[model samples]
Target: MSKSLRTLLNEIAACRHCVDNPDGTSLPHDPNPVLRADKSARIAICGQAPGTRVHSSGVPFTDPSGDRLRDWMGVSEEQFYDVQRIAIIPMGFCFPGLDEKGGDLPPRRECARLWHARLFPHLTRLDLILLVGNYAQKWHLGKERKSTLTETVRNWRQYLEMREGPGYMPLPHPSWRNNSWIKKNSWFEKDVLPRLKVEIKKRL
Candidate 1:
Protein backbone atom coordinates (compact mmCIF):
# COMPACT_ATOMS: atom_id res chain seq x y z
CA MET A 1 0.00 0.00 0.00
CA SER A 2 1.08 3.57 -0.52
CA LYS A 3 2.26 5.74 2.32
CA SER A 4 -0.42 7.99 3.75
CA LEU A 5 -0.48 11.66 2.77
CA ARG A 6 0.23 12.58 6.38
CA THR A 7 3.36 10.44 6.39
CA LEU A 8 4.65 12.00 3.20
CA LEU A 9 3.97 15.45 4.57
CA ASN A 10 5.93 14.65 7.70
CA GLU A 11 8.86 13.56 5.54
CA ILE A 12 8.59 16.82 3.64
CA ALA A 13 8.53 18.82 6.84
CA ALA A 14 11.70 17.11 8.02
CA CYS A 15 13.53 17.46 4.72
CA ARG A 16 16.94 19.09 5.00
CA HIS A 17 18.44 17.88 1.74
CA CYS A 18 18.33 21.30 0.18
CA VAL A 19 20.48 22.82 2.85
CA ASP A 20 22.73 19.89 3.71
CA ASN A 21 23.41 18.47 0.29
CA PRO A 22 22.48 20.90 -2.46
CA ASP A 23 24.63 19.93 -5.45
CA GLY A 24 27.03 18.41 -2.90
CA THR A 25 27.45 21.78 -1.20
CA SER A 26 25.77 23.45 1.80
CA LEU A 27 23.10 26.08 1.43
CA PRO A 28 23.81 29.68 2.34
CA HIS A 29 21.32 29.32 5.18
CA ASP A 30 19.27 26.70 7.02
CA PRO A 31 16.48 24.90 5.22
CA ASN A 32 12.95 25.42 6.35
CA PRO A 33 10.62 23.42 4.16
CA VAL A 34 7.40 25.39 4.19
CA LEU A 35 4.38 23.50 2.87
CA ARG A 36 1.10 22.21 4.21
CA ALA A 37 -1.48 19.67 3.07
CA ASP A 38 -4.02 17.19 4.32
CA LYS A 39 -5.72 14.14 2.83
CA SER A 40 -9.07 15.86 3.12
CA ALA A 41 -8.09 18.85 1.03
CA ARG A 42 -9.95 19.26 -2.25
CA ILE A 43 -8.01 22.23 -3.60
CA ALA A 44 -4.26 22.43 -4.15
CA ILE A 45 -2.34 25.68 -4.47
CA CYS A 46 0.86 24.91 -6.37
CA GLY A 47 3.04 27.99 -6.31
CA GLN A 48 6.71 28.97 -6.41
CA ALA A 49 9.22 28.77 -3.58
CA PRO A 50 8.82 30.59 -0.30
CA GLY A 51 9.91 34.22 -0.35
CA THR A 52 11.93 35.67 2.51
CA ARG A 53 8.88 36.68 4.53
CA VAL A 54 7.29 33.28 4.03
CA HIS A 55 10.52 31.51 4.89
CA SER A 56 10.78 33.54 8.06
CA SER A 57 7.15 32.98 8.99
CA GLY A 58 7.25 29.29 7.99
CA VAL A 59 3.81 29.68 6.52
CA PRO A 60 2.99 29.64 2.87
CA PHE A 61 1.54 32.79 1.28
CA THR A 62 1.74 34.93 4.41
CA ASP A 63 2.63 38.23 2.76
CA PRO A 64 0.99 40.87 0.57
CA SER A 65 1.22 38.45 -2.32
CA GLY A 66 -0.81 36.00 -0.27
CA ASP A 67 -3.37 38.69 0.41
CA ARG A 68 -3.78 39.23 -3.32
CA LEU A 69 -3.92 35.50 -3.94
CA ARG A 70 -6.68 35.08 -1.41
CA ASP A 71 -8.59 37.96 -2.97
CA TRP A 72 -8.20 36.42 -6.41
CA MET A 73 -9.43 33.08 -5.14
CA GLY A 74 -12.35 34.83 -3.43
CA VAL A 75 -11.36 33.22 -0.16
CA SER A 76 -10.82 34.66 3.27
CA GLU A 77 -7.60 34.22 5.25
CA GLU A 78 -9.17 31.48 7.33
CA GLN A 79 -10.30 29.51 4.30
CA PHE A 80 -6.99 29.90 2.53
CA TYR A 81 -4.98 28.63 5.51
CA ASP A 82 -7.26 25.76 6.37
CA VAL A 83 -5.18 22.78 5.29
CA GLN A 84 -8.18 20.50 5.39
CA ARG A 85 -9.81 22.56 2.66
CA ILE A 86 -6.76 23.64 0.67
CA ALA A 87 -3.26 22.23 0.28
CA ILE A 88 -0.39 24.69 -0.08
CA ILE A 89 2.61 23.21 -1.88
CA PRO A 90 5.24 25.01 -3.87
CA MET A 91 7.61 23.97 -6.63
CA GLY A 92 10.39 24.43 -4.12
CA PHE A 93 9.54 23.92 -0.49
CA CYS A 94 12.36 26.10 0.86
CA PHE A 95 13.71 29.52 0.07
CA PRO A 96 16.44 29.29 -2.59
CA GLY A 97 17.98 32.56 -1.47
CA LEU A 98 18.16 35.91 -3.31
CA ASP A 99 19.66 36.70 -6.67
CA GLU A 100 22.26 39.35 -7.44
CA LYS A 101 19.47 41.71 -8.52
CA GLY A 102 17.87 41.47 -5.03
CA GLY A 103 14.90 39.44 -6.28
CA ASP A 104 14.16 35.89 -5.20
CA LEU A 105 16.12 33.23 -6.96
CA PRO A 106 14.39 30.56 -8.95
CA PRO A 107 13.10 27.61 -6.92
CA ARG A 108 15.64 24.89 -6.43
CA ARG A 109 14.89 22.05 -8.85
CA GLU A 110 15.57 19.37 -6.24
CA CYS A 111 12.42 19.72 -4.13
CA ALA A 112 9.96 19.04 -6.93
CA ARG A 113 12.12 16.32 -8.42
CA LEU A 114 12.37 14.66 -5.05
CA TRP A 115 8.89 15.10 -3.69
CA HIS A 116 6.01 16.08 -6.03
CA ALA A 117 5.51 12.72 -7.72
CA ARG A 118 5.48 11.03 -4.34
CA LEU A 119 3.03 13.47 -2.86
CA PHE A 120 0.54 13.90 -5.73
CA PRO A 121 -0.75 10.36 -5.97
CA HIS A 122 -1.83 10.39 -2.35
CA LEU A 123 -3.86 13.56 -2.75
CA THR A 124 -6.76 11.58 -4.19
CA ARG A 125 -9.33 13.98 -2.81
CA LEU A 126 -8.10 16.96 -4.80
CA ASP A 127 -10.77 18.39 -7.10
CA LEU A 128 -8.89 21.38 -8.46
CA ILE A 129 -5.30 22.65 -8.65
CA LEU A 130 -4.34 26.30 -8.89
CA LEU A 131 -1.08 26.49 -10.79
CA VAL A 132 0.21 29.85 -9.66
CA GLY A 133 3.09 31.38 -11.64
CA ASN A 134 5.25 30.22 -14.55
CA TYR A 135 7.25 27.57 -12.71
CA ALA A 136 4.17 25.73 -11.55
CA GLN A 137 2.56 25.93 -15.01
CA LYS A 138 5.68 24.56 -16.69
CA TRP A 139 6.04 21.71 -14.20
CA HIS A 140 2.44 20.60 -14.12
CA LEU A 141 1.44 21.27 -17.75
CA GLY A 142 4.68 20.15 -19.45
CA LYS A 143 4.46 20.19 -23.27
CA GLU A 144 0.79 21.01 -23.01
CA ARG A 145 1.69 24.46 -21.66
CA LYS A 146 1.67 27.41 -24.04
CA SER A 147 4.93 29.16 -24.89
CA THR A 148 4.35 32.14 -22.69
CA LEU A 149 2.73 32.60 -19.27
CA THR A 150 0.18 34.98 -20.81
CA GLU A 151 -0.81 32.48 -23.47
CA THR A 152 -0.99 29.59 -21.05
CA VAL A 153 -3.15 31.53 -18.59
CA ARG A 154 -5.30 32.92 -21.39
CA ASN A 155 -6.03 29.37 -22.47
CA TRP A 156 -7.06 28.27 -18.98
CA ARG A 157 -10.27 26.78 -20.30
CA GLN A 158 -8.36 24.33 -22.43
CA TYR A 159 -6.43 22.95 -19.48
CA LEU A 160 -9.52 22.79 -17.33
CA GLU A 161 -11.32 20.80 -20.01
CA MET A 162 -8.40 18.53 -20.80
CA ARG A 163 -8.37 17.05 -17.34
CA GLU A 164 -11.19 14.63 -16.70
CA GLY A 165 -10.65 14.55 -12.95
CA PRO A 166 -9.02 17.32 -10.94
CA GLY A 167 -9.27 20.59 -12.89
CA TYR A 168 -6.16 22.72 -13.49
CA MET A 169 -6.15 26.51 -13.64
CA PRO A 170 -3.07 28.61 -14.37
CA LEU A 171 -2.72 31.98 -12.67
CA PRO A 172 -0.10 34.69 -12.49
CA HIS A 173 1.87 35.25 -9.29
CA PRO A 174 0.03 37.65 -6.99
CA SER A 175 3.15 39.66 -6.14
CA TRP A 176 2.90 43.44 -6.21
CA ARG A 177 5.48 43.28 -8.98
CA ASN A 178 2.80 41.80 -11.24
CA ASN A 179 0.33 44.58 -10.54
CA SER A 180 0.92 45.99 -14.01
CA TRP A 181 0.39 42.60 -15.62
CA ILE A 182 -2.90 42.27 -13.84
CA LYS A 183 -3.90 45.73 -15.07
CA LYS A 184 -2.99 44.87 -18.64
CA ASN A 185 -4.98 41.67 -18.57
CA SER A 186 -8.44 42.98 -17.93
CA TRP A 187 -10.07 39.73 -18.99
CA PHE A 188 -8.37 37.84 -16.16
CA GLU A 189 -10.52 39.76 -13.71
CA LYS A 190 -13.59 39.88 -15.93
CA ASP A 191 -13.51 36.29 -17.18
CA VAL A 192 -11.22 33.95 -15.23
CA LEU A 193 -11.82 34.94 -11.62
CA PRO A 194 -15.53 34.16 -11.68
CA ARG A 195 -14.88 30.70 -13.09
CA LEU A 196 -12.14 30.17 -10.52
CA LYS A 197 -14.48 31.12 -7.71
CA VAL A 198 -17.15 28.76 -9.00
CA GLU A 199 -14.72 25.89 -9.05
CA ILE A 200 -13.40 26.75 -5.60
CA LYS A 201 -16.90 26.84 -4.25
CA LYS A 202 -17.64 23.39 -5.66
CA ARG A 203 -14.61 21.92 -3.91
CA LEU A 204 -15.23 23.76 -0.66
Candidate 2:
Protein backbone atom coordinates (compact mmCIF):
# COMPACT_ATOMS: atom_id res chain seq x y z
CA MET A 1 0.00 0.00 0.00
CA SER A 2 2.69 2.49 1.11
CA LYS A 3 5.91 3.16 -0.76
CA SER A 4 9.14 1.71 0.58
CA LEU A 5 11.88 3.83 2.13
CA ARG A 6 14.03 3.35 -0.96
CA THR A 7 11.21 4.62 -3.11
CA LEU A 8 10.76 7.75 -1.00
CA LEU A 9 14.52 8.41 -0.98
CA ASN A 10 14.66 8.09 -4.73
CA GLU A 11 11.88 10.62 -4.97
CA ILE A 12 13.83 12.93 -2.67
CA ALA A 13 16.94 12.51 -4.81
CA ALA A 14 14.97 13.55 -7.87
CA CYS A 15 13.40 16.56 -6.17
CA ARG A 16 13.91 19.89 -7.95
CA HIS A 17 11.26 21.91 -6.18
CA CYS A 18 13.77 24.08 -4.37
CA VAL A 19 15.56 25.01 -7.56
CA ASP A 20 12.74 24.80 -10.07
CA ASN A 21 10.24 26.57 -7.85
CA PRO A 22 10.78 28.09 -4.41
CA ASP A 23 8.00 29.74 -2.41
CA GLY A 24 5.92 28.79 -5.44
CA THR A 25 8.59 30.70 -7.42
CA SER A 26 12.20 29.81 -8.39
CA LEU A 27 15.68 29.30 -6.96
CA PRO A 28 18.75 31.22 -8.08
CA HIS A 29 20.88 28.12 -8.70
CA ASP A 30 20.53 24.43 -9.45
CA PRO A 31 19.32 22.14 -6.66
CA ASN A 32 21.52 19.43 -5.18
CA PRO A 33 19.59 17.93 -2.29
CA VAL A 34 21.95 16.08 0.05
CA LEU A 35 20.85 13.60 2.72
CA ARG A 36 21.15 9.98 3.87
CA ALA A 37 18.83 7.58 5.65
CA ASP A 38 17.68 4.01 6.08
CA LYS A 39 14.76 2.43 7.94
CA SER A 40 17.05 0.54 10.30
CA ALA A 41 18.78 3.63 11.59
CA ARG A 42 18.60 4.18 15.34
CA ILE A 43 19.86 7.73 15.40
CA ALA A 44 18.94 10.78 13.32
CA ILE A 45 21.08 13.86 12.85
CA CYS A 46 18.89 16.86 11.99
CA GLY A 47 21.27 19.62 10.99
CA GLN A 48 21.12 22.85 9.02
CA ALA A 49 21.62 23.05 5.26
CA PRO A 50 24.71 21.82 3.47
CA GLY A 51 27.82 23.97 3.37
CA THR A 52 30.21 24.45 0.43
CA ARG A 53 32.20 21.26 1.13
CA VAL A 54 29.06 19.17 1.71
CA HIS A 55 27.38 20.60 -1.42
CA SER A 56 30.41 19.75 -3.53
CA SER A 57 30.82 16.29 -1.99
CA GLY A 58 27.09 15.53 -2.02
CA VAL A 59 27.61 13.95 1.39
CA PRO A 60 26.03 15.47 4.43
CA PHE A 61 28.45 16.40 7.22
CA THR A 62 31.56 15.62 5.19
CA ASP A 63 33.48 18.50 6.67
CA PRO A 64 35.26 19.66 9.83
CA SER A 65 31.88 20.09 11.50
CA GLY A 66 31.30 16.38 10.98
CA ASP A 67 34.60 15.66 12.63
CA ARG A 68 33.47 17.48 15.74
CA LEU A 69 30.00 15.89 15.64
CA ARG A 70 31.52 12.43 15.51
CA ASP A 71 33.75 13.36 18.40
CA TRP A 72 30.73 14.50 20.37
CA MET A 73 28.83 11.32 19.57
CA GLY A 74 31.92 9.20 20.30
CA VAL A 75 31.62 7.66 16.84
CA SER A 76 34.25 7.14 14.18
CA GLU A 77 33.87 8.20 10.54
CA GLU A 78 32.94 4.67 9.54
CA GLN A 79 30.16 4.47 12.12
CA PHE A 80 28.93 7.97 11.44
CA TYR A 81 28.50 7.39 7.72
CA ASP A 82 26.78 4.04 8.10
CA VAL A 83 23.29 4.84 6.87
CA GLN A 84 21.95 1.73 8.58
CA ARG A 85 22.98 3.18 11.94
CA ILE A 86 22.29 6.88 11.49
CA ALA A 87 20.05 9.07 9.35
CA ILE A 88 21.52 12.41 8.34
CA ILE A 89 18.86 14.93 7.40
CA PRO A 90 19.09 18.69 7.26
CA MET A 91 16.49 21.42 7.70
CA GLY A 92 17.17 22.37 4.09
CA PHE A 93 18.01 19.52 1.71
CA CYS A 94 20.23 21.76 -0.46
CA PHE A 95 22.70 24.52 0.15
CA PRO A 96 20.74 27.79 0.34
CA GLY A 97 23.59 29.81 -1.11
CA LEU A 98 25.47 32.59 0.70
CA ASP A 99 24.43 35.66 2.59
CA GLU A 100 25.73 39.22 2.32
CA LYS A 101 27.98 38.55 5.33
CA GLY A 102 29.62 35.67 3.40
CA GLY A 103 28.04 33.07 5.67
CA ASP A 104 25.85 30.31 4.35
CA LEU A 105 22.20 31.38 4.10
CA PRO A 106 19.51 29.92 6.33
CA PRO A 107 17.90 26.70 5.13
CA ARG A 108 15.10 27.01 2.59
CA ARG A 109 11.82 26.47 4.54
CA GLU A 110 10.29 24.55 1.65
CA CYS A 111 12.48 21.51 2.36
CA ALA A 112 11.03 20.56 5.77
CA ARG A 113 7.63 21.70 4.62
CA LEU A 114 7.79 19.17 1.83
CA TRP A 115 9.94 16.24 2.97
CA HIS A 116 10.46 15.68 6.73
CA ALA A 117 6.97 14.35 7.54
CA ARG A 118 7.25 11.89 4.68
CA LEU A 119 10.78 10.82 5.49
CA PHE A 120 10.58 10.49 9.28
CA PRO A 121 7.59 8.16 9.29
CA HIS A 122 9.72 5.59 7.46
CA LEU A 123 12.59 5.61 9.92
CA THR A 124 10.88 2.93 12.01
CA ARG A 125 13.78 2.14 14.28
CA LEU A 126 14.93 5.62 15.26
CA ASP A 127 15.48 5.97 19.03
CA LEU A 128 17.16 9.33 19.24
CA ILE A 129 17.37 12.50 17.18
CA LEU A 130 20.16 15.01 17.55
CA LEU A 131 18.86 18.47 16.70
CA VAL A 132 21.90 20.41 15.59
CA GLY A 133 21.75 24.19 15.11
CA ASN A 134 18.96 26.73 15.54
CA TYR A 135 16.75 25.87 12.57
CA ALA A 136 16.36 22.25 13.55
CA GLN A 137 15.70 23.13 17.17
CA LYS A 138 13.00 25.61 16.26
CA TRP A 139 11.26 23.22 13.88
CA HIS A 140 11.40 20.18 16.12
CA LEU A 141 10.84 21.75 19.52
CA GLY A 142 8.68 24.79 18.62
CA LYS A 143 7.38 26.57 21.72
CA GLU A 144 9.20 24.05 23.88
CA ARG A 145 12.52 25.43 22.63
CA LYS A 146 14.25 27.92 24.85
CA SER A 147 14.69 31.53 23.83
CA THR A 148 18.34 31.06 22.95
CA LEU A 149 20.41 28.26 21.44
CA THR A 150 22.65 28.08 24.48
CA GLU A 151 19.67 27.78 26.78
CA THR A 152 17.96 25.15 24.67
CA VAL A 153 21.09 23.01 24.51
CA ARG A 154 21.73 23.47 28.20
CA ASN A 155 18.23 22.17 28.81
CA TRP A 156 18.51 19.11 26.58
CA ARG A 157 17.49 16.78 29.40
CA GLN A 158 13.97 18.20 29.40
CA TYR A 159 13.40 17.41 25.76
CA LEU A 160 14.96 13.99 26.11
CA GLU A 161 12.61 13.14 28.94
CA MET A 162 9.53 14.51 27.21
CA ARG A 163 9.96 12.71 23.90
CA GLU A 164 6.99 10.53 22.91
CA GLY A 165 8.85 8.23 20.58
CA PRO A 166 12.37 9.07 19.42
CA GLY A 167 14.11 10.99 22.17
CA TYR A 168 15.30 14.50 21.14
CA MET A 169 18.52 16.24 22.13
CA PRO A 170 19.36 19.80 21.19
CA LEU A 171 22.95 20.57 20.29
CA PRO A 172 24.90 23.53 19.04
CA HIS A 173 26.23 23.20 15.53
CA PRO A 174 29.68 21.64 15.41
CA SER A 175 30.95 24.21 12.91
CA TRP A 176 34.39 25.64 13.57
CA ARG A 177 32.69 29.00 13.88
CA ASN A 178 31.29 27.85 17.23
CA ASN A 179 34.68 27.10 18.75
CA SER A 180 34.25 29.92 21.21
CA TRP A 181 30.80 28.69 22.20
CA ILE A 182 32.16 25.22 22.97
CA LYS A 183 35.01 26.66 24.96
CA LYS A 184 32.66 28.80 26.99
CA ASN A 185 30.27 25.93 27.69
CA SER A 186 32.43 23.56 29.65
CA TRP A 187 29.47 21.65 31.10
CA PHE A 188 28.47 20.41 27.66
CA GLU A 189 31.66 18.42 27.37
CA LYS A 190 31.63 17.34 30.98
CA ASP A 191 27.94 16.45 31.27
CA VAL A 192 25.98 16.28 28.02
CA LEU A 193 28.49 14.44 25.86
CA PRO A 194 28.73 11.52 28.25
CA ARG A 195 24.97 11.11 28.27
CA LEU A 196 24.80 11.45 24.49
CA LYS A 197 27.42 8.75 24.01
CA VAL A 198 25.62 6.40 26.39
CA GLU A 199 22.33 6.82 24.53
CA ILE A 200 24.04 6.27 21.17
CA LYS A 201 25.72 3.10 22.41
CA LYS A 202 22.43 1.75 23.72
CA ARG A 203 20.68 2.31 20.39
CA LEU A 204 23.56 0.87 18.38
Candidate 3:
Protein backbone atom coordinates (compact mmCIF):
# COMPACT_ATOMS: atom_id res chain seq x y z
CA MET A 1 0.00 0.00 0.00
CA SER A 2 1.06 3.58 -0.61
CA LYS A 3 1.94 5.94 2.23
CA SER A 4 -1.17 8.02 1.58
CA LEU A 5 -3.41 4.93 1.76
CA ARG A 6 -1.74 3.78 4.97
CA THR A 7 -2.10 7.24 6.48
CA LEU A 8 -5.79 7.42 5.57
CA LEU A 9 -6.45 3.99 7.11
CA ASN A 10 -4.73 4.97 10.33
CA GLU A 11 -6.71 8.20 10.45
CA ILE A 12 -10.00 6.35 10.06
CA ALA A 13 -8.99 3.83 12.72
CA ALA A 14 -7.94 6.51 15.16
CA CYS A 15 -11.27 8.38 14.95
CA ARG A 16 -13.27 7.65 18.15
CA HIS A 17 -16.15 10.09 18.02
CA CYS A 18 -19.56 8.51 18.52
CA VAL A 19 -21.29 10.61 15.90
CA ASP A 20 -24.16 8.10 15.74
CA ASN A 21 -24.84 7.33 19.41
CA PRO A 22 -22.50 9.71 21.27
CA ASP A 23 -22.68 7.18 24.14
CA GLY A 24 -20.61 4.61 22.28
CA THR A 25 -21.63 1.20 20.90
CA SER A 26 -23.17 -1.32 23.32
CA LEU A 27 -21.32 -3.87 21.26
CA PRO A 28 -18.33 -2.00 19.88
CA HIS A 29 -17.81 -2.11 16.12
CA ASP A 30 -14.59 -2.55 14.18
CA PRO A 31 -13.55 1.09 13.89
CA ASN A 32 -10.83 0.31 11.38
CA PRO A 33 -12.54 0.22 7.97
CA VAL A 34 -11.49 -0.70 4.45
CA LEU A 35 -12.60 1.46 1.54
CA ARG A 36 -11.76 1.95 -2.14
CA ALA A 37 -8.15 1.79 -3.38
CA ASP A 38 -4.86 3.72 -3.42
CA LYS A 39 -5.90 6.37 -6.00
CA SER A 40 -5.52 4.45 -9.27
CA ALA A 41 -8.93 2.74 -9.22
CA ARG A 42 -11.22 3.48 -12.14
CA ILE A 43 -14.39 1.72 -10.97
CA ALA A 44 -15.82 2.28 -7.49
CA ILE A 45 -18.15 -0.30 -5.91
CA CYS A 46 -20.20 1.21 -3.10
CA GLY A 47 -22.37 -1.13 -1.09
CA GLN A 48 -23.77 -1.61 2.43
CA ALA A 49 -21.78 -2.64 5.51
CA PRO A 50 -19.52 -5.64 5.73
CA GLY A 51 -21.26 -8.93 6.46
CA THR A 52 -20.08 -11.32 9.19
CA ARG A 53 -17.68 -13.16 6.91
CA VAL A 54 -16.30 -9.96 5.43
CA HIS A 55 -15.73 -8.42 8.85
CA SER A 56 -14.00 -11.51 10.14
CA SER A 57 -11.83 -11.94 7.07
CA GLY A 58 -11.07 -8.26 6.49
CA VAL A 59 -11.78 -8.72 2.81
CA PRO A 60 -14.85 -7.23 1.20
CA PHE A 61 -17.17 -9.44 -0.83
CA THR A 62 -15.71 -12.81 0.22
CA ASP A 63 -19.08 -14.55 0.47
CA PRO A 64 -21.73 -15.78 -1.96
CA SER A 65 -23.11 -12.27 -2.31
CA GLY A 66 -19.75 -11.27 -3.80
CA ASP A 67 -20.04 -14.15 -6.21
CA ARG A 68 -23.29 -12.71 -7.51
CA LEU A 69 -21.78 -9.23 -7.64
CA ARG A 70 -18.85 -10.50 -9.68
CA ASP A 71 -21.24 -12.32 -11.99
CA TRP A 72 -23.25 -9.14 -12.46
CA MET A 73 -20.15 -7.17 -13.31
CA GLY A 74 -18.88 -9.97 -15.58
CA VAL A 75 -15.51 -9.82 -13.87
CA SER A 76 -13.29 -12.62 -12.65
CA GLU A 77 -11.92 -12.90 -9.10
CA GLU A 78 -8.55 -11.60 -10.31
CA GLN A 79 -10.07 -8.48 -11.84
CA PHE A 80 -12.47 -7.88 -8.96
CA TYR A 81 -9.57 -7.88 -6.47
CA ASP A 82 -7.48 -5.51 -8.54
CA VAL A 83 -7.83 -2.25 -6.64
CA GLN A 84 -6.30 -0.31 -9.50
CA ARG A 85 -9.23 -1.41 -11.65
CA ILE A 86 -12.05 -1.92 -9.13
CA ALA A 87 -12.50 -0.17 -5.79
CA ILE A 88 -14.79 -1.43 -3.00
CA ILE A 89 -16.22 1.13 -0.65
CA PRO A 90 -19.29 0.35 1.43
CA MET A 91 -21.73 2.89 2.88
CA GLY A 92 -20.80 1.71 6.35
CA PHE A 93 -17.27 0.58 7.16
CA CYS A 94 -17.91 -1.91 9.95
CA PHE A 95 -20.40 -4.71 10.50
CA PRO A 96 -23.46 -3.06 12.11
CA GLY A 97 -24.40 -6.33 13.85
CA LEU A 98 -27.77 -8.11 13.49
CA ASP A 99 -31.40 -7.03 13.84
CA GLU A 100 -34.10 -8.57 16.03
CA LYS A 101 -35.36 -10.68 13.13
CA GLY A 102 -31.86 -12.18 12.69
CA GLY A 103 -31.09 -10.10 9.63
CA ASP A 104 -28.15 -7.72 9.37
CA LEU A 105 -28.94 -4.19 10.51
CA PRO A 106 -28.56 -1.04 8.44
CA PRO A 107 -25.28 0.90 8.22
CA ARG A 108 -24.27 3.52 10.78
CA ARG A 109 -25.03 7.21 10.10
CA GLU A 110 -21.63 8.58 11.14
CA CYS A 111 -19.62 6.58 8.59
CA ALA A 112 -20.68 8.41 5.44
CA ARG A 113 -20.52 11.79 7.10
CA LEU A 114 -17.04 11.14 8.46
CA TRP A 115 -15.40 9.38 5.52
CA HIS A 116 -17.16 10.12 2.21
CA ALA A 117 -16.15 13.76 2.07
CA ARG A 118 -12.59 12.81 2.99
CA LEU A 119 -12.45 9.86 0.56
CA PHE A 120 -14.08 11.51 -2.47
CA PRO A 121 -11.16 13.86 -2.91
CA HIS A 122 -8.70 10.96 -3.40
CA LEU A 123 -10.78 9.24 -6.09
CA THR A 124 -9.62 11.69 -8.78
CA ARG A 125 -9.99 9.36 -11.75
CA LEU A 126 -13.03 7.25 -10.82
CA ASP A 127 -14.93 6.54 -14.05
CA LEU A 128 -17.85 4.39 -12.86
CA ILE A 129 -19.38 4.36 -9.40
CA LEU A 130 -21.58 1.31 -8.82
CA LEU A 131 -24.10 2.40 -6.22
CA VAL A 132 -25.07 -0.99 -4.84
CA GLY A 133 -28.02 -1.09 -2.41
CA ASN A 134 -30.32 1.69 -1.16
CA TYR A 135 -27.85 3.34 1.19
CA ALA A 136 -25.42 4.19 -1.59
CA GLN A 137 -28.26 5.28 -3.88
CA LYS A 138 -29.66 7.58 -1.19
CA TRP A 139 -26.28 9.24 -0.62
CA HIS A 140 -25.43 9.72 -4.30
CA LEU A 141 -28.89 10.34 -5.79
CA GLY A 142 -30.31 12.27 -2.75
CA LYS A 143 -33.31 14.55 -3.54
CA GLU A 144 -33.35 13.20 -7.08
CA ARG A 145 -34.57 9.86 -5.68
CA LYS A 146 -38.17 8.70 -5.80
CA SER A 147 -40.27 7.64 -2.80
CA THR A 148 -38.92 4.09 -2.86
CA LEU A 149 -35.88 2.17 -4.08
CA THR A 150 -37.82 0.38 -6.81
CA GLU A 151 -39.11 3.62 -8.21
CA THR A 152 -35.67 5.21 -8.12
CA VAL A 153 -34.13 2.24 -9.93
CA ARG A 154 -37.02 2.08 -12.39
CA ASN A 155 -36.30 5.68 -13.22
CA TRP A 156 -32.55 5.06 -13.34
CA ARG A 157 -32.45 6.58 -16.80
CA GLN A 158 -33.03 10.02 -15.28
CA TYR A 159 -29.56 9.91 -13.71
CA LEU A 160 -27.91 9.10 -17.01
CA GLU A 161 -30.28 10.84 -19.42
CA MET A 162 -28.25 14.03 -19.31
CA ARG A 163 -24.67 12.85 -18.71
CA GLU A 164 -21.95 11.08 -20.64
CA GLY A 165 -18.92 8.91 -19.76
CA PRO A 166 -19.17 5.88 -17.43
CA GLY A 167 -21.42 7.48 -14.83
CA TYR A 168 -23.37 6.24 -11.81
CA MET A 169 -25.61 3.17 -11.95
CA PRO A 170 -27.71 2.13 -8.97
CA LEU A 171 -28.29 -1.54 -8.23
CA PRO A 172 -30.10 -3.53 -5.59
CA HIS A 173 -27.90 -5.58 -3.26
CA PRO A 174 -27.26 -8.93 -4.90
CA SER A 175 -28.49 -10.88 -1.90
CA TRP A 176 -30.96 -13.76 -1.90
CA ARG A 177 -33.73 -11.38 -0.81
CA ASN A 178 -33.49 -9.40 -4.04
CA ASN A 179 -33.89 -12.43 -6.29
CA SER A 180 -37.66 -11.97 -6.33
CA TRP A 181 -37.31 -8.25 -7.03
CA ILE A 182 -35.00 -9.03 -9.96
CA LYS A 183 -37.53 -11.47 -11.38
CA LYS A 184 -40.39 -9.01 -10.93
CA ASN A 185 -38.52 -6.23 -12.66
CA SER A 186 -38.17 -7.63 -16.17
CA TRP A 187 -36.57 -4.43 -17.38
CA PHE A 188 -33.54 -5.27 -15.24
CA GLU A 189 -33.12 -8.39 -17.29
CA LYS A 190 -34.08 -6.87 -20.62
CA ASP A 191 -32.55 -3.43 -20.35
CA VAL A 192 -30.17 -2.97 -17.44
CA LEU A 193 -28.31 -6.29 -17.33
CA PRO A 194 -27.30 -6.17 -20.99
CA ARG A 195 -26.16 -2.60 -20.70
CA LEU A 196 -24.29 -3.39 -17.50
CA LYS A 197 -22.42 -6.23 -19.20
CA VAL A 198 -21.48 -3.94 -22.07
CA GLU A 199 -20.13 -1.40 -19.61
CA ILE A 200 -18.08 -4.02 -17.76
CA LYS A 201 -16.67 -5.27 -21.04
CA LYS A 202 -15.58 -1.77 -21.96
CA ARG A 203 -13.77 -1.35 -18.66
CA LEU A 204 -12.13 -4.77 -18.82
| Structure candidate 3, residue pairs in collision | none
RMSD of 3: 2.5
Highest lDDT: give the candidate number: 2
- lDDT for each residue of candidate 2 in 61-165, tens digit (9 for 90 to 100): 888899889999999889998999999999999888887798998899999999999999999888899999999999999999999999999999999988488
lDDT of each: 0.90, 0.90, 0.79
Clashing pairs for model 1 are none
Question: After aligning candidate 3 to the native by TM-score, how far in Å is the CA of 89 from where it should be?
Answer: 0.8
Q: Could you tell me the lDDT of residue 112 within candidate 3?
A: 87
Model 3 CA lDDT for position 103 = 90
For model 2, the superposed segments whose C-alpha errors exceed 4 Å read 1-3
Better of 1 and 3 by TM-score: 1
